[model samples]
Target: MDHWSSLSMGKNVLMERRERADAARNRQAILRAAEELLRRHPPEQVSVERVASAAGVGKGTVFHRFGSRTGLMLELMTERARELEQAVTEGPPPLGPGAGPAERLVAFFAAVAALAARNGNLMAAHEHAMVTRKSAAEQPREANPIYLFWHRHVSELIAERRPDVDAGQIAHMLLGTLHMEPVASQLRAGQYEGLAASFAAIVRGLMGEE
Candidate 1:
């Protein structure tokens, strides 16, 4: 159209793009800070000010970006959990489509074992916070999305492998039995090898095979 109209449209596009870019950058900063805190210490120990310092931003910026400490923790863990879930459900893996139940179960446990060993602090921190005070809504539901994802994945495996067995019960048992809490806690305290093997052995038993 006319030059004035074209200039106005161009200006609007530039402004929108700039806002999106800034939002992305701010998100990255917050996540980076959270990740750094996760590496050095648990989430419980990492305050908004600490995260702000780590992210090279103001405390106000962090709060404005994430709204609250819980909000920031959720954002951080959500990214990681969603990645793992997608990997199991959709990404290439023994857990991915086409793999047999036994293989998928084993693979899923293996992945959990690794995640636990690696992210023990983050897990413990979230747990400690949750226990100190329960939220009314529990917006995300059931501790964390990772556990729910694991429940679903393991149940599906059971359904495939042993149609006679109660998949729901199996899911519950696995949720309680081979969960990350105990294993990861032990791992955090420096019992890595045994816990890792124990996880594999447990998975083997679950599969009803050697």
Candidate 2:
């Protein structure tokens, strides 16, 4: 309405935008730090204090942003899945558009396996929580959201290359190997050599190719 009032409102909006941008930047930093820590240490060894220190943020900031350690882990897991989803949907070549169905399937499985390996302990912690719920009725009846998404992607790729095969079942089989627990087990067992190639071989085998 008035000049000063309008100017004040505009300044307030700009301040709000700046705060949101800063918050987003801080969140990304924390996630990056947490991922690095998880790579170097087990999930139990990671903590809000450590993540905040590694990210160069205040402990209160970590708590304020994520609420708790479990909350942070869940957000990190979701963020990792979101990144993969974005890559497959919009990223380059094999993971995105332009590659043949077989190529895409191989790339997709490899990417998924890599993501799972990186987030292994964090995800396995979540899976343990899911199973240890007091009430089985309160647990999710459907598959984990990330798993369902991968399953759908794999199924679509399989359908494109081999429509006659049981895409759904075959997708499930491939994904079983890519699960966080299984991949983490393999990695811990020092069996990560040529992991991506193994995933490709499995995909090719599922496609009934030589």
Candidate 3:
């Protein structure tokens, strides 16, 4: 190709790369801002304009990146869910690959409880929004990918230790105890006193002296 044409093509490629990098940076900023805002305030107060202002991006940029408020919240939920899943599947011991099933199960519940403690409001808001949308009404709480992953993980752990027991039912029961309302209630009542100890006790009972 001609020298001018080659230079123009190179410039275009560089511009595209820069644009992609900027978009990624903006996305991260928006997520961070949204997370911080949601942590400090309720979901109704966390508007796109507020998030955009906190993120230092134009309001239109937030919509352009996430399509809508519901879309943004779903993206955040997906990100947090995937991060927790990775920690349980691939990260350090107890929660990850290196520990025995019993130990891993204990760690798994603790991690899930912590996750719910941190993001329970955000998760509930996201679920409510999804349920409100006509197209998403059929997707129940059980259909949540994070919940599915947790259920399967707990069932596998139960199966490993108690082959004769009904692992799936027990798994659901264990997960129910870790639900946001229960955990929040426990926190309110005990001020998080012996939280780990309580989880250990439950784990022992569930795993049956293992």
Candidate 4:
């Protein structure tokens, strides 16, 4: 199983509990196998057959568990999301429900950027996965949970300050700047320290404040 590829909550929920449980167990086994392989072997050398054999299953189980190598990667992304959600939901103060919306918004993006930098391949993988699906049938995964989390905070913050402006659009605009890689790269290149200030100013401007 690819760590990030096959984690489809919606797809699994439809399964009978037994099937779901079995799938989950198999999924875990596959992930463990992949993790072990990653520690010892290069990714390209770790084939689906190798993964299945490591997990004590047939080669087809690899295909069933994750549609393909790409599916495996997507599962990994989902794992990352689950881990991040668990961290913020269970671990500490700044990330939990008690933080103010504006503060939370800042904390969220900085954390995401740091996570992206650490994972290094995550953003590129995500863009690839998303672009692939955009060409296929149906909506892309409601993949917004991570993105929406911050957008919601921005919306709430705007609502507090503006009362009348469309918090939705304002939230999109502010978070758009924060999460946009081009803007982030510019900020990282020492092009400006003003990005944060500019973000704040835009949010404030949306609220009709100077």
Candidate 5:
């Protein structure tokens, strides 16, 4: 190519790299701000405007990046669950690999319960936003990456333990419990141990184990 054309292409590439870096920084800042606000206040009090002010970004930027409050909350949930996801993917047994299906399923439930307990406010806000979004859209719930991962994991375990049953539907039922307001309230109240135990019992029954 000509020298001028090569120079213009190089500049465009550099500009794109800078833009990506800036977007990444903005995303992290927004998430951190949102998390802090959720920790300090009730869900209703933590608005996108406040989060934008805290993150030093324009309000429109938040919407542009996340689509809506529900999208932002979902992104935050995904961020918070990253560690648990990694553990399930590659960490030690039970929570990770090399355990029986029942044992692994139990461990996964316990981990999720603990995570919910720790982020009760965030979870509540997410649920509220989700409800609002669902009503406005009047459509199926948006696909959540974290939920998809958990659902896939649960379905695989259920299938491994009981090949005759409908693992996908069962997985949906199991996860549906976690989204219930009562369950979320229990989690926020630090009843994760009981919740986990109850889930374990249910899973055991489903697997035909004593």
Candidate 6:
């Protein structure tokens, strides 16, 4: 319309773009700071204030972006798992496509176990923070995005191989065993060895393979 109006609209659009870019940069900086803190100190020691200072942002910014430490941890978990999720969605077989359901299931569980083993501390911290949040306000574990993705994938694979049984319930049962605390404990105790084979045998049994 008018020249002045067009100039104002362009400025607003530019401002919005800059805000989004700044938010993205702040998010990555916070996550990286939190990760380094977790590596150096225990989860309980890593606070939002500490992360804010490390990321060179104000504490209010961290709280505004991630409601609480639990939220921050969950976002970090999602970030770390993003690559694995992408691989499952679009990468090669058996982790991706082009493989039987049983094989894919096995690969998926093994990959999850490996991820957990590598990030045992982060997993444990996330679990601890989640528990603390749950005590104050009930938050359903099923609502977690990462868990939902894994559950959906497992359910589909199970349903493909065993149409009679309740794939959803079976997927839940299997995922329960792979939860953060138990998997972290197994990793800590050095008992995580041979986990892949164990997972494969269990998957084959569920698939009714010989």
Q: Mind sharing the TM-score for model 5? A: 0.89
Misplaced by over 4 Å in model 5 are 1-10, 134-142
Error of 2 at 8 (Å): 3.4
For residues 87-156, write the lDDT of model 4, one tens digit per residue.
Answer: 6667565555566555545555555555544443443444444655434542343344666655565577
Clashes of 3: 0
Compared to the true structure, candidate 1 yields what TM-score? 0.80
Winner on TM-score between 2 and 5 is 5
Residue 20, candidate 1: Cα error in Å is 0.8
**Cα RMSD of predicted structure 6:** 2.2
Ranking by lDDT: 5, 6, 3, 2, 1, 4
- TM-scores for all candidates? 0.80, 0.69, 0.77, 0.56, 0.89, 0.90
Q: Which candidate do you rate higher for lDDT, 4 or 5?
A: 5
* Top lDDT model: 5
Which tens-of-lDDT digit does each residue in 1-210 have in candidate 3? 999999999999999999999999999999999999887886767888999999999999998998777778878988988988998888999899888888998787777666665676676657555655445434555666777888999999989988999999988887776545766656433334356568778878877864
Model 2 off-target regions past 4 Å? 49-71, 78-87, 90-93, 118-145, 180-182, 188-191
Report each candidate's C-alpha RMSD, comma-separated, in the order given. 3.0, 4.1, 3.3, 10.2, 2.2, 2.2
lDDT of 1 by residue, 64-144 (tens): 887667667767767777767878768775857777777777777667666656666766655555555455554443556
User: 85-199, model 2: which lDDT tens digit per residue?
Assistant: 9989999979998898889988886776677666567766555545544454442513657667888888999999898989999888776664556666875444554778888
lDDT values for all models = 0.72, 0.77, 0.79, 0.60, 0.90, 0.87
Clashing pairs in 6: none
- Winner on lDDT between 3 and 6 is 6
Pick the winner on TM-score between candidates 1 and 6: 6
Lowest summed-lDDT stretch of 10 residues in model 4?
A: 134-143
TM-score of 4: 0.56
